[model samples]
Target: MKEDKRPILVFGATGRQGGAVAEALLKARWPVRAIVRDIAAPKSVALRQAGAELVEGSFADLDTFRAGMDSAHGVFSVLPANLSETEEVRIGCGIADLAAESGVAHLVYSSGASSGDTPTGIARFDAKPRIEAHIRWLPVTATIIRPMIFMDMLINPAFGLSEGRYTFFLRPDQSMQLIAVEDIGKFVAAIFADGIRFSGRTIKIASDTVTGRQLGEIFSEAAGRPVIYSRFADEVLAANSDLGQLAAILDNGPLADHVDLAAMREINPEIISFRAWLATQRHQAFDALIGSDRTSHSA
Candidate 1:
C-alpha cells in the first residue's frame, strides 16, 4: 500500500466501474469515499469492507455531491443510462460541475467509445459527447476516459446467449472494441497516480478488438464446447423495437471503431485482453453462457 492520503470521491460506487475504481484506490492505500444511494445495499457494504468511506447520495442531489467533493483530491464519475435522458445528463454534468467548483485536483469522467461527432441516433451513447464537452471547459484539470463497449454486455441475460447460439449486432466479419469492467478501475487509478501527465486529455480505453467470429471461437475454446455467432435475426429485432434500433446503430455506426492499442498499453500496462480474461475467470457467473449445463438467467 502506497499510503496516499488524499481521498477520491467515486460516483456509481455500487456498480461495476465504480466498484472496480474503489477497490483499486483502496489497494493503492489511497483514501476512497464512494457515493451510494443506499448504504444498506450489499455492494455498499462490500465497499466499506474494502476500506471505502460510504456516503448515501444520488446524482440528483447536488448538495451531497458538493459535500463529497470537498477535500477530495480526485473524483471518479460515471452516470448510468436506463433509457432516461434527463437523469443521465444531469448526473454526468452535475459531478463535473461539482468537481470543478470544489477545486478538485483531478477529475476523471467515464464516457463511452460510441460518442463522437456523428450521432448514432441513440440518446444514451450521444449524451456523453455533450457531457464531455461540458467537462472540458471546467476550471479543474480533467480527463475523459471513453471506454469501449463493455465485454460484460455480451454475457447479459437479455441477449439470449444461453440458447447455445449467440446473437449480436455485428456480422461475423465486423470487428468491435470492448473493455473489461475490472480494467476500468486499474486504468483510472493509474491516471490518479500520474495526474500531471494525464490531465486535460481525452483517451479511449479499450482492452481488445474482436470480430463476431472471433467471439465464437474464444467462447468455444474457453467453455470446451461449440458456440456459434450470428447476426441478430431480423425477426427478433423487428419484434424488439428498442433492441432493433441499437443493433442497427452497432452494425452501421462507428461504435465498433478500433483503438490505438500501443498507446493504451503505455497508459495501463496490465490491460486484459478478452481471451486472457476468459482464461482467468473461473466464476460460475460466466459459465451460464458457455457451460455444458446452461441455466435460465439474464446476463
Candidate 2:
C-alpha cells in the first residue's frame, strides 16, 4: 500500500497525547509534521528520527503555528492544560482560525471531558466550549473530541495509590468512563483517515466504565493486596476548592462519560480497556505506585 505523503500538522508533538497521535499516524503510513519549541529537544529529535517533519515553535507565537500548517492535509490541535484558562481559550481558537485560513482539509481539536453545551462554571471546563463554538463558526472541517478522564492519572502517587488507597471524585458505586492515553491517538488517526465521517462532529470518547468499588477490586488484583478505593473525604474537598468543584461536577452528572463504547469501538478497533492498559504499562513500574508485589509474582 502507498503511504499518504500529505503531512498532518500536529501541535505539541513532544507531549503525551500528541506523541501518541504521531506514532499512530506514522504507523498508518500518514506523514506527520510536528511543531515543538526546540527541534533539538530530545523528544523532538525522537519525532524527527521516527520520520516526522519538525517545525520549531511555541504556542504563544502564531507565525510559528502558521509555518507548521503550510500545505498541510490536516491539523491536530491540543493545548497543554497548565496554561491560564484565558490563554488556553486564545490559543485553541487561534489554531482553529488558522486552520480555516490555511485551507487545511480537517482540524481535530483535543478538548476536555468537562466541556459541553452549557457552561461548566469552571474556567478550565469552560475554555474548550468557547474554542469549540469558535471552530463551529469558522469555514473549516473540524472535529471536536472531548476525551474522558485519563486512566494514566489514576496511578499517580498524589491520588493515594502509593499508600494502598485510591481517592477520587466519584462514589464507590458511581461509575465513570476511562480511556487509555494511547487510545486518543488511535481515534484521532482514524478520524483523519476517514475523508468525511467525522467533520463538524463533537465526540465524547472513553474505553471503559468502572465504578469506584470496581476500581478497588481491579487495583487489588493488580497489586496483589486490598488496595482500598474511596471518594475524597468531605474535609479534603473542602480544603481544596478546585478539587471540590471537580467532584461536585461528577456528582451532578456533567462530568460523567456519556459516549457509547460500542460505537467508539467501530471507529477505532484498537481501543483497549483499562485493565489492558494497566497490564501493558506495568513495565513502567506503575505497579510500584499501586503497591504491586513484584517479588511475590516473580516467586
| Alpha-carbon runs more than 4 Å astray in model 2 | 1-4, 282-285, 295-299
CA lDDT, candidate 2, residue 169: 83
Evaluate residue 131 in candidate 1 and report its C-alpha lDDT on the 0 to 100 scale.
89
- Model 1: how far residue 280 lies from native, Å: 2.9
**Residue 282 accuracy (lDDT) in model 2:** 51
Screening candidate 2 with a backbone cut-off below 3 angstroms (N, C-alpha, C), the clashing residue pairs are none
TM-score, predicted candidate 1 vs. hidden true structure: 0.89
Best by TM-score: 2
* 157 Cα displacement, candidate 1 (Å): 4.1
lDDT of 2 by residue, 97-122 (tens): 99999999999999988887777667
lDDT of 1 by residue, 226-268 (tens): 7778888888889987778777667766575678887888877
